[model samples]
Target: MAKSATLYRMATDEHICPFGLKSKDLLKRKGYELDDNLLTSREETDAFKNKHDVKTTPQTFIDNERIGGYDELRSYFNKSEAGQQGTTYTPVLAIFAVTLLMAFAFSYASNFALLSLNTAELFVALTMGVLAIQKLRDLFSFTNSFITYDLLAMKVVRYAYVYPFLEAFVSIGMIAALPAYTVAPISLFIGGVGAVSVIKAVYIDKRELKCACVGGDSNVPLGFVSLTENLFMIGAGVWMFIK
Candidate 1:
């Protein structure tokens, strides 16, 4: 006889549990014939939970053995664990990946080509726009993180709040084909300030701190990546002015 599994999950008009779907898919992929039970109402769901002595939906049982929740099932199958949230470069990587694609699309649309120097400019502007959005998501948290290592932000606390807006302004202006003479100087000033702060904090001060590059929620260490972002901005500004 083939091995079989039983799953009790929540399914309703208002809410179809995502974890339930994942658990079902996992069982299917593992070749288990599932006897799926949907708890469709609040009363039914609560009664089911009480009967099983379980606090959550999406419980799985295989071969008369309880397998707990999705994470537990993954453990049973020796799969990489999921839903462990931590500080990661995921935000920055995602931003750059999307910006790269957008830059390519813009280039192809304008010049019928996928690559050009103009694409680099577009990439910088798009990247700045994305980073600005991240910072603006939780301005207070971002400001708190920014002041930790940023020299200007330490001396002038308002700079932390202004930084995102300034980044957005220069990036949007560049994207709009505004006069380089106007926005380029602003970029240079901000970039120079940022680079110096990062250098002093990481190299000179040797303070281990989180980067505010992708906002306060990021775990990216304050170092080379932070320095590189500032350098890119400075380089972009110079390129716009000269070429």
Candidate 2:
């Protein structure tokens, strides 16, 4: 005989249990014949729960043995726990995606062809501005985190607080299409400093630390993404100066 499972779930006019659906799908995927017992009303559902001596719906039974809830079902299959992973580049990626979209929109609005130099500049500027704002969200916290890995911040504490504003100022200048002579040098100075700091902390010192690139509270590691941000700024500044 084929293995079979029974699921007791609640499905009413106003509400249907989501976990119940998940449990049912899991059973189907595991090749178990499901005997679905859906309580159609609130009273029926309450009575069923009370009768089972359980506090929740979506209860599963396999061969007359209760198998508990969705998480429990996953555990039975030895699957990794859901939603327990650490942070990644998702935040920075999201910001970059938005900046690129904004740059395209601005380029179209200015009657410039798509993918113009102006669009590229604007994209870089907007990305910096967004990142600066993230740091400014909790400036003190960012400073505290930055001082741990930033070479300059470690020596001169005030630089930690001033960094975000400088980034924002340079970003605004680029976005406004101001004279590159003035903005480019500032960009180069800050970018060069940042790159040096990150290299010393990550490569030379081999320190494991959280990057303040996104903000102090972020879980983004102080590695490739942080280095990329500094290198990008340096590249943009160099291009602007020579162009």
Candidate 3:
């Protein structure tokens, strides 16, 4: 939201954000000139919100003016006079599926695995499930220091692109190398991934987003933090795939 508005302020280019990326691509496929801010700069973030005094998540602004939320964005797509240029939030559905899949899959897998230590191999699937959801969500900002306005776009990009991959690799390594189920790397990764997915998905959906990773969020895509939080786990999935 902030990224899109900031781009609007600087240029006519409209950026699509599925929560951040999924939604971003969804918009571009509909023909909007869009940029992916999955690695947005702090300046862009602050300036966008400060320019419009946005108080809520997924807020939309047009031509340096406050336009409102998802409904307004929908109107914009509809070509209403009150709306600005808009794009379809379809990618949000894909993202939603990924998130919800991990949420339910890993959650159940973990609960069942609790029955036996020998079943710890199940953790690999569970952790990878969480990783998939998080990557789709892309909430990797928490992987490093608090992102500040002082950080350059290059810095943000480095963090966004590299951190999740590393986190995922680490999770995979632990899973492959650690041999003890009692605290085996596999079980730990699965536990970490499942716990984080459900907690973040539920809390963020509860407090700021009405949609819980399904098309429902097209009405209001998941926020950056939620997406970023999931990104690490998503990267973990990538690692699992490679391993």
- Candidate 3: where is the Cα deviation over 4 Å? 1-114, 118-121, 129-155, 179-243
TM-score of each: 0.91, 0.67, 0.25
RMSD of 1: 1.9
Among the numbered candidates, top lDDT falls to 1
Estimate, for each residue in 1-243, the C-alpha lDDT of model 2 and write its tens digit.
888999998899999999999989989999999999999999998898888898888899997888888888888778766553676778888999999999999899999877788788888899999999999999998998999988888999999999999889889988776788878888888888889988988999999888999899888889888888888789878878777
Tell me which of candidates 2 and 3 scores higher on lDDT: 2
Summarize candidate 1's per-residue lDDT along 1-243 as a digit string, tens digits: 877999999998899999999999999999999999998998999999899899998899998999988988889999988953655677778888999999999998898467678898899999998888989999999999999988999999999999999999889988998899988988898899999999999999999899999988788778887888888789978987997
Over 37-154, each residue of candidate 3 has an lDDT whose tens digit, in order, gives 3324446756766866764335544456655554456566674443323433444545545545554555576575443432333343344444434543544433322122112313
Cand. 1 TM to true fold? 0.91
Alpha-carbon runs more than 4 Å astray in model 2: 1-84
Ranking by TM-score: 1, 2, 3
